[model samples]
Target: MVSAPTNLPSALAAALAERGHEVVVHTRRVDPDAPERQRLPSGVVVQQIVAGPVRPIVEQELAPWLGEFGRALAAAWRDDRPDVVHAFSWASGLAASAARQQLRESTLIRNGAAAAPLPVVLTFTAFGAEQHRRQGPVDPGLANRIRLEVALARSVAAVIAGSDDEVEELARMGVPRERVTLVPPGVDVSRFTPYGPSAERTDAPRLVAVGDLTPSSGFDTVIAALRGLPGVELVIAGTTSGDASEELERLRAGAEQLELADRVTFAHSAVRDPAARSALLRSADAVVCVPWHGPVGAGPVLEAMACGIPVVATAVGAVSDVVVDGVTGVQAPPRRPDQLATVIRGLLGDPVRCLGFGAAGADRARSRYEWARIAVDAERAYRALVPAALPAVDDELIHSNE
Candidate 1:
């Protein structure tokens, strides 16, 4: 699997290994001292391949490295070919496409974001409005990147969508309907199950939100919703540094303005261990995911459901897919603070109802979103792409067979 330098692919690689599959994660760069290979209990292998340096400034550094990285992938594939190659981003898809031309036996799997080519101009106007509201100027590079991603997606054997909303987005971008597959992100249900009885919270309903505390995530909206709610405590676990620090401070000030300073707490500390993060999810009465911009998917929604916690989320991107209207959790319109507060208030008021939603969410997750099931589906897709034997035809053979 090829992905950018991030934690998403790392978790996926580990989960695939746990499902008894050999997983090799390829990123743009790697630490030389890192172990070359690690064997899991299921006998799966993980090989990390760092193609090159990934610099943020696209023109000065990333452009040249992209070409070099593509060539390096071709060279590596020529030495030893794998049965299937899964590419996570557009650049990875381009590399896998090049390698497939060299080694005719391998199947290419592609996954990433998709955007419409000519989104009625109003889309850009709306994006500009949102950008001006948060940041100063809109980045033109965002639109260009979306177009390139759409082009690269068309060249793969199968495209794995992280959400149903993303599938619709890809369809709008001219990808053939037959090639797209809806494979939403999966979670390790066992690891994130309900915590011990002693760890449960018995006070007022605890609402937990986790993500990079940025404007795009609409964390400010969540803060706004919690402002006047009595006896409700909000715990936000995520980073408040870099570009997001200013926004985080703004949110804190807002909470203070509403006289909710004591009720809200920001856990700037990282839950470095997965067990800790899982425990946090299990301890919460409900998980709140509110994003202003519609993302393809959010990991917290799945994690919360895995822990048997009802979710309250904005109806953006694939969030609706994970949080059924009243089954798993409640869905409110994006950026609507009042609606968000109302939903949370309703859920908190009815403990038995919220518990039922949490139970249904856990059942859904176990039945449909397990990593083991996803691995089997992925393996089946790979086999379908690779043929058992090559077809042979000659003048004499054709005549005799006929």
Candidate 2:
């Protein structure tokens, strides 16, 4: 697996490793003094490739060094080649593609015939064209990034989409639908559960919104929804203490302007600590996620569902697929605070309905969105690309363990 160091990729690598696959994660060497290779407790190997300056940098800025990173990967894998290379994000896909090409060229020179390019499966967390369409080319590197992303998608063996909306987006970008697979992101079911201790809250109904407090995050819509539901308090969990980003400031000012300063609490600690995040989700009457663009904000929504909390989300991306409307949760059009408020009010007013949604949500989350199931889905995609590469599963052993 190739990706920048992040929670989702790390969890996925660990899950794959636990499922008896030899997982090796390759990432750029961000810290000057960090080891080039380290083994995680989950038995996954982390190999940091030297690309540019050994310091932290954003993905957009890191693009220039991807070629060098690819060369390093090619050298490292010359002898110990992985059967399947799964890349997360556009940057990783570019590097994986380059490395595969490099290996193929090397084989052609060394042998009589050209060796087959290593099979690579890519998962784009968000598409560049989608973002450019929604937010414009705000980042200077965005245009070039979009071009590279489209080419990379075309070159990859397969593309794993996190949502149905993303699959459609990929098709519009000229990627064949047969090469795309829909595998929604997963949650840690054991950590997030209905039985866990909930965070302290007032008797008034509560709504929790989790994610970065950017303009596109739709947190302002959440605050607006509070205006309609008088006694309801809104908890926004994302920022850390002492970090004064402009977006966080804007959200605070907006909340104050709407006279919801007391009603809206920015829980800085909840996003950093897993225990606190789970507790906050458990305390929520419903978790709200209404990002204007981007892949379904899977982290917050899936985690909330796993905790058996009813979700009140925008009918965007794979959210509808995850949260069954009027069953597991309620869905409203994006940016419509009135509709969001109405849905929240309806869900909160009927405790029986809320309980039913929570129960159904918990069942859905456990059955479909757990990490174990997600790993299986991923493995299937990998095997489809290169069936002989992965080890065959032993059904008798699985049954014995169960």
Candidate 3:
């Protein structure tokens, strides 16, 4: 079940369905007139469960609507129960748990036999602890979110963590180590490749940074680093024009203050289109990802690598795992502009090293980060629970490249 607005859930659903699994996605109603059940072009079933208003609400505001959402899920699964209930976030996990409990109770009351419970698999995009550490105690909802995440982690059959850092964090929060699996998010290798057309660039070298235009995103560090590298231009591709207008202004103001306004370009519309985003990556001489926290995942870094562009990312989250320092790309500490600049200067100065890193990065991305490969890993996780819930037949049907 996808409880948030992130793209990962739908992408994963599509990938899983492509592997011949019967995937049904449950999400809250965003349009009042839309049908309750719909099918995507990829043939995945999507059920828009009624909970609250059709209007969009923040993730924190979703707490009050969960009961209704869970009931709706239970109703949908009453006639046909799925072997595994995979939830994409903490909110989804809570709703899935409630629905499973309701199903179990109904089965027990009807037949007087204990039905084998539906196993729920969970994946948390970002843990509350990481948020608390980054945003600090000023956030009022942080405590409650952390507590609920801990409880949900313990309740789920399996937890897929995007990074080794996340696995350690879950262990510190009291979740068993055995229950957590390390599965980094995948990238679309076919779309993001070196063969694609790149975004327009000047004769000067370019460094592209992609993420939300927030203070913690560390775009400022890139801007600061640009001051030292005189000839190179930087393109920070995020913060679409209308959305986050304030942040857009803030970043522009920072660039102006540093007297490097002409050198930096903000590609506002690049993120909304896959082709444009891939083009932007291909245009980059090197991609710089220096977010202050681990929640950024390895998305931009991996996409950049997939495009055969060298990366200079902070050693946080799965990015640290994906980028091999001095091999595929360079890794640096977060919030360090001087150190980041030094590496960028070195990388941009040597064309042979840049080509080497880019080639290696593309190889790693194709070999390890493909969507099909990730779907297989997820299928294995689902198969682990299926034997206890359903009859097992043949194992030869499944194959693995990892």
Candidate 4:
């Protein structure tokens, strides 16, 4: 498995390893002092590779390093040729496909573009639009990033999309339907399920929002909604990287302006570290995740449902597919603070109704979004791409100089 060492990729790698697969993780960063080899319970072997930083390298330096990295990956593949190679994001997919070509192996690519338009462009455009609306026109690095994504997408053999929306987007960008597969992200229901009675909380109907403090995530919108309602505390969890500092500050200011500084508490920590995050979610009355523009994956929503917490999220992207409004949870219009506030308040006022939604959410999560089912689907796809065994061919030397 080749992917960036991000949250989703790490989780997927662990899940794949747990399924009795010999997983070799190719990452962009690996500390030299760290353990050289760590064995998983199912005997998976993880191999880490530091591909160097993309930010500091100039175009001239970048091209050469990428070529060298490609050569190294090719050499590794030739040494231990696997049945199939799975690449996780567009960039990694491009690199993995190039390496696979050298080793003559089949490749499977998974889309980790959480939001539509790629990460850099999405962030720049979102921040630019917000800044432009408030001040004036600004130069957003959107066009360049879109061009890069289009180029990268064209090079992959098969693109595994996280949702139908992503498939449609990839299709519009010239990727054929046959090349695209809709595979929604799955949650480990066994780890996230609400097994016992709901935990007790002292606060007046706590509502939680978990994700990075970025503009696209719209945690600010949740804060805005919280301002409209009294006796409701909104807990915002998740750490922000350098790019999101400005947005985080802006949200803090907004909370202060709305007199919700005391009501809204910001927890600059990860919402994925099982123990801490599970405890936080279990104590919540409801969970709210409203992203402005997203084919939102199964992170916050799934975790909340697993903890038997009703969710109120924006009806954008895959959220509607996850939360079956009124049954599992509630859905509000994207960017509409009033609607979000109303839904949150309703859930808080009626504990019994909220409990019913939570129970339904838990049931849906366990039934449909289990990681075992997802892993089987992925393994099936990998098997379909590779034949049962190889046939010996004539010893003919062929060379291409194109």
Residue pairs that clash (backbone atoms under 3 angstroms), model 1: none
Worst 10-residue lDDT window, candidate 2: 393-402
Q: Roughly what TM-score does model 3 have, to 2 decimal places?
A: 0.94
Model 2 off-target regions past 4 Å? 137-140, 239-244, 387-402
For all candidates in order, the CA lDDT equals 0.62, 0.80, 0.80, 0.62
Candidate 4 segments exceeding 4 Å error: 53-64, 104-145, 196-201, 239-243, 270-272, 390-402
**Decoy 4 TM-score against native:** 0.81
lDDT per residue (tens digit) for residues 128-230 in model 3: 8888887667466778888899999998888888888888888988889888888878899989999979888889999999766677779999999987798
lDDT, candidate 2, 165-239, per-residue tens: 888888988999999988888889999999989999999888998655567768889998888899999999864
lDDT of 4 by residue, 109-136 (tens): 2333221111110000012122233444
Clashes of each: 0, 0, 0, 0
lDDT score at residue 118, model 1, on the 0-100 scale? 9
lDDT of 1 at 69: 60
How do all models score by TM-score?
A: 0.80, 0.93, 0.94, 0.81
Candidate 1 matches the true fold with a TM-score of 0.80
Worst 10-residue lDDT window, candidate 1: 393-402
**Local distance difference test, candidate 3:** 0.80
Question: Residue 268, candidate 3: how far off, in angstroms?
Answer: 2.9
